[model samples]
Target: MARTLLIAGTASHVGKSTVAAGLCRHLADRGVAVAPFKAQNMSNNARAVPRATEPTEAGEIGVSQYVQARAARTEATTDMNPVLLKPRGDGESQLIIDGEAVENVGAGEYYEAGWERAREAARKAYSRLAAEYDVIIAEGAGSIAEINLADRDLANVETARFADADVFLLVDIERGGAFASLYGTLELMPEDLRDRVVGAAITKFRGDPSLLESGIVEIEERTGVPILGVLPYDDPGLPQEDSVSLPAAGETALYGDSSEVRIAVPRLSRISNFTDLEPLAREPGVGVAYGPPETVLEGADAVVLPGTKNTVDDLLELRTSGFGERLRTFSGPIVGLCGGYQMLGERITNAAVEGTGDEATVEGFGLLPVETHFSREKRVERVEREIRGVGPLAGALGRVTGYEIHMGETALTGPADRPFRDEGAATEQVFGTYLHGLFENRVAREAFLDRVFEYAGRMRPESHAEPSPYERAGALVADHLALDALGVSHENMSERV
Candidate 1:
């Protein structure tokens, strides 16, 4: 068994992932064999690392592992995103273990069948990663302070004690309820496990970090635990893996120069498996921006409709948000994967699944000659196969390998005359499929970029694809943290007898 330190947050988005990654990288900088783990993650921004060989398990994936890989200073995406869940609408999640789809299970539906089974899944993954490392830093999900959800939640307070992990609690001071968050957390903490915690932390501080002294005093006086390092908020430059249902309406990089190729992604509700665009965002001339549904798509060479957790709800939301109108009117090349593919269809029959908080067969925009339905059987695992010509996906129809993790299945409504070499044409303006991470491959990437480049009326550089910026950024953080010694390394673990 490896020495494990489990981190939990007072609430969501308090930078738990950031702290875990930082510590792993910080410790690994000293040559320590350290890894990161998250037993259950609800984020839809799944990254398919070709390196993970384990069978994809249901409702399991590790985005934090990517953070640890960076900390360990390695270029292994698979070592991080080993288990993934690309959610399909109707409370059913597309369970993927080790980059492969297994089946779909609804929220609180399959767990009743077994808890030992889920624990075993985590144990197996932990064991596999433990074999290659010395210390494993684990992260827990959501607020651990919720008394009602303690036992049922797999990644809650009980899990920390069950795993026999050293606990580190984090509170987001920026949320304006720091005192309440800290007090409530300690009050709700299980008595037997209170002693297990080594320290509590403050995250996302914008103003004077020194102001944390008073907050620390209050928490210590109330909870009787010491404060750990007050991590000053800094941009680690890595994209967040989020499970947000509402579309994020903010632009990061939609503008600079039209001469530079820009990829606009509609900030659709319930977007899942969003990590697909991380590779594109890292490209130099390529820019990835997010914003409100309508405005986000205004200026761009190519627009991407990413995967989603709830496709119907998101489409309904897109319609309400005025984005659906813009999408139909937009002339630029549009590409969609998984849930996004469902949106570009003639109809999405909700007879099997209800995503928009309703249980009715909703109407879909008659774009692509296709329709979709939520299925009990999920396609979760990875497939390194060819994507043939269909719809707007003609010239680029070639062999490209990626994973398929979605709950809904889509088929063309009718056969077309325009002989799509790989298949029949759904239409000319829209292209979609069950595949994720289509642009990671060189040939497919170049073809996609060529379309964007032409749309932008500019020529792309000769060398199009390159290494991800996260690798470079991770390496930089690793080097910087190495200066301050924390005593964690492969050699530090045992004498080389």
Candidate 2:
């Protein structure tokens, strides 16, 4: 059996995912066989991993668990995150149980009838992971102290009970009221769950740690909890777990200003896997900005339509918002991914399958000579294919790996060049592909950047290698946190194993 450590947060977006990732890397560095688990996660950002029960089939898990698996130096599996709730607008969400899409249900229905099944699936998944790894670093969702939801909370309360895990509570000082939130959280948690907390750490502190000593000591005295450490504010540039990390719509967020070549990405209403643009943003001298459909193309050297949860709906919004008209007049390199690919086609049939409306067909932007048909069956699989090097990928020629998670089938309706064998359609300056994480490939990223810089008549800056995010995260945790107090040192290796 494996020992478990649950990383619980004070609230949503308080750096729980990052802290969990850091601990995963830190433990892996100490020769411990570790794995990441999130019993239930609600996020639109997801990645395809092999299903534990069906190894040959690809299944979906939240992106945070995927990143944590990488940080732990372990292969990602759907069992790492057994239940995922992808919100499809309104009050409903698509429930994924054991890496398969079960059904779409509203919050009330899920809690009333679906939660029991979800909990059972999560229990089995965690059991398998515990048997395989020496230590399981589990991440809690939202706040561990949601009193109203304590009984039904699978990610926090239920996990703490079933996994018999020690808890490390994380509070964000940047949000202000750090001590109050920490104290209140501990106070509100169920007695059994609260007793499981080994210690508390304040994260995202900007200034010196000494400034917080007096308050930390007082809080520890009042609550009978140890203040393990205060981590200085620093982002390791990991993939964001949800859209909460993204800038508000219509706001232009420029990553780097050194490069004159700007790649504009429209902030779709329900963007999914926007991590695809992170690679481009990481490139030197290149700038990737997310803005509204109307003005994102302004002064942009290239345009990228990102994947969305709802293709027909977002496409209709783009057209109504005048982005469709602006895109038609822009003479620059354009690329569409997944739902974005469907939007680039000539038409989409059976749109009712994925849309909220009753429409059976919807018109696409027609940038690519392709048509799409929606079906009840969604394609979710990891794929590797050769680049045909057409259109925006003119000079790129190599095998690239990515995953496809979508609800439609697309095919060419007219003569057009294929960008990735038969996977995507392309013209002279437009490209559309269902592949996610395309830019993660060096060849594809370089080729696309080269074309964008050329179109902007600017020099592409020399590339430089950066440190791995996992290594950075590990270093951050080791340098700041008191690993000894957490019983995560080399000396206790035998005991944990």
Candidate 3:
């Protein structure tokens, strides 16, 4: 029996994904061979996985499951994500199956056909992983309580049904209605599915589990389901899913107490492509934190000026917050990616498109004399280029593929002033370029982090532990499943759901 676990949320931000990832991490540490799953996830954050047998649409994979794969130490994103949806503006989304896009369809019509297709895709994907790992921990879509919608083609309950998922987990905590949310979600799920639910968990609990002990009892009494556990919030080993979603590195540090070394990243309104600091957080003596612009990056190692969707607006805010000037004089290694890269330059074009039907340009910080233009043809493909001379990053980018969903084309003012011939990995202090997942390249992480530590006046610790992200993600899934009231173990990974 291949055991399958489902983590359904009480509400959107009730810590479903975060909780699930943590569980996966713990399980992997326990030597449980685990795989992470999510039936359907809706987000623009996607990744490239080439190992899947059945070809889906290229550029249609969500990076959410990829996060779980990393935690579990899995390498193939295709093996983890078989179906993905990238939403386009007006009521329609791009359908990506098995890692490739077949076509774009209206949301309603897609739902009319996406479930069975998604189930088949996920099941097949899971089957491949199941052969390799012992257990698969899955995540559910929006509130299972969302009745009318789930019936159509939502992957949550449908996954439980089709995947033969053995255990169901209700993640309820953040929103005050956790108790009701859990009970209600359980009650609304199909009876057979409900019976299969292993247990309910109170995740992301803040104060104390004792505070909710009584409520837990009442919950068990009402649903006839056991309260598996109340997991206290641990601040370590957690990575930010996407830049828009603020990342809390578990505030985890491997060999240090970073109470002394502090780093500040702006809480930008529309921040994008912020996976930059994953490498630093894994450094032995480093600590990463997010804060407002008021905090002087003083006594801090460096400041990261991440990317923004609307550069003009975010740049204006950066100037207003005085971070713009601060960056110029920060005297440390200041770096930016994509939109952030544009801001560090002379000016950014496309300001006119802010609201008016006109195209416009906005002056950048003028640090790098590069100009960018917005074009109709957006580059959304995997890119590979060699870094010339910026920092210690001078090497051939070996399949250093990353997605480029940007509308900007950059041109350096002169030959000597190119921002990025490749992607900015080799740039010294004040480097900016349009590349995502820059550190995903082992060479990039080493090159960038080495320069970064030197700029911070610290010796890069030799004992640095570069995390095998997919492995950590998988272990977390397994831990959650074991703690799950369902008592799922590696031996049961073959169980239907």
Candidate 4:
């Protein structure tokens, strides 16, 4: 039986996911058999994990839980995230339970009829994981103090109650009003739930700790909960769980010289698998920025259209926002992944399957001579592809491994260049593929970036010397956390032996 600990937040994007991931890594390093859980996650950014019954069977879970499981040195399973809601357009979400998509439902309908089933799914998954791991670090969503939604908040209050988990309330100081927010959250929470909180940790603090000493003391004095360690604003550079964590618009990259190759990603309203850009952002002399929908594609060396939860709707949004118009005229190295790939085609058939109501066909960007048709069946699996083509990114000739999660099948109409030979098209500088984590493969990224820099008349910098993002996350957590207070004791391996 695993002992559970809850990481709850004062508000959304207050570092709950990062804290849980850090704790998972820290505990695993201590030889503790750890796992991560989130009863319900509302994010389009997801990762496919294996099923417990059939290891070969694949299913989707929140990306944060998947990464945390990796940090814990365990194979990711759907039990880690029992219920997932990928928001589609028109106030509806594709509800996934026990790692499979059941149906798409509106917000009101989901609460009225679907909440109980989701709850049961979480319970069963938690029970299975509890029996396996020695410790489970559960993550809570949004503000735990959302009074109106408390009864239906599956991730926070309900999880703590069912798991008998001790809570660590996290407040983001960089957002300002950390003390007030923490105090208000604690005050608003129900008494039974409030009693479960062990302490409050202030996150994203930029200044010295001593400056907050008096404030922390006052907060502790006002509330029964003590102040835990204050974590600095150092980003461990872990994969963010949601698009809400994106850097401010137009502030995506710190622009510098012509030597830097800037990649512009027009921010999609329903962007999914955003972590696909993380590897590119980490590349030496490369800057990845999220261009607003209306912004003109001017200075970027290359442009990437990212994956989306609702392909038709997001594509329509791009057109209405005028980005599609600018994109048609812009001549640059452009790449589209998954849903974005579908949008680059000439037309999309069976659009009603994606909740477009009666609309059967929608116009695409027409960059590639391809057509896509939506279907009830979804493709979600890990894949390794060989890059072959005579197009722009053909230099990226290697075995590229990634995953595909989409509801549409794109067929190239004319005899054109295929980047992955079978999966994607590469017409001149425009590339489209279904692979989500395409840049993670260094060989492919190197080949692709070499062409991009050559096209931009710039020199690609040498390989980055910084540690991998995951390594930095592990070190950051180990340094900032108070493990003793969290009931984790570092034990010598020899002693265990």
The most accurate candidate by lDDT is: 2
Instruction: Name the best candidate (by TM-score).
Output: 2
Model 2 / residue 426 / CA error / Å: 0.6
Ranking by lDDT: 2, 4, 1, 3
Task: Please list the C-alpha lDDT of all candidates, in the order they appear.
Answer: 0.64, 0.90, 0.63, 0.84
Candidate 1 lDDT over 7-71, as tens digits, reads 78889888777767776666665677777777666666765454444334322255556545666
lDDT accuracy of residue 244 in candidate 3: 38
Candidate 2 residues 133-210, lDDT tens each? 999999999999999998899999999989999999999999999999999999999999989999989999997788
List TM-scores for all candidates, in order. 0.73, 0.98, 0.74, 0.94
lDDT tens digits, residues 1-497, model 4? 67888999999998888888888887787788889999999999998778665678778898999889988889899999999999886798999998888999999999999999999989889999999988899999999999999899999988998898889899999888999999999999978889999888999888778999999899999997888688889887778788776655544543223357888888777889988988877777888878676763668878889999888888888888888788888777888889888888899999978846578899999899899999999988878888774455766666878788889788988876877656788788788999988888887777678878888888777774786555666776677766666565455322322
Collision count of model 2: 1
| Candidate 1 residue runs with Cα over 4 Å from true position | 26-31, 47-62, 65-132, 177-180, 207-226, 245-262, 284-296, 299-301, 316-325, 347-375, 386-400, 408-429, 442-447, 458-497
**Residue 228 accuracy (lDDT) in model 4:** 68
lDDT of 3 by residue, 30-95 (tens): 677777877666655666555467343234356667677666666545656677776543566667
Q: Give the Cα-based TM-score of candidate 1 against the true structure.
A: 0.73
Residue 370 miss distance in model 1 (angstroms): 4.9
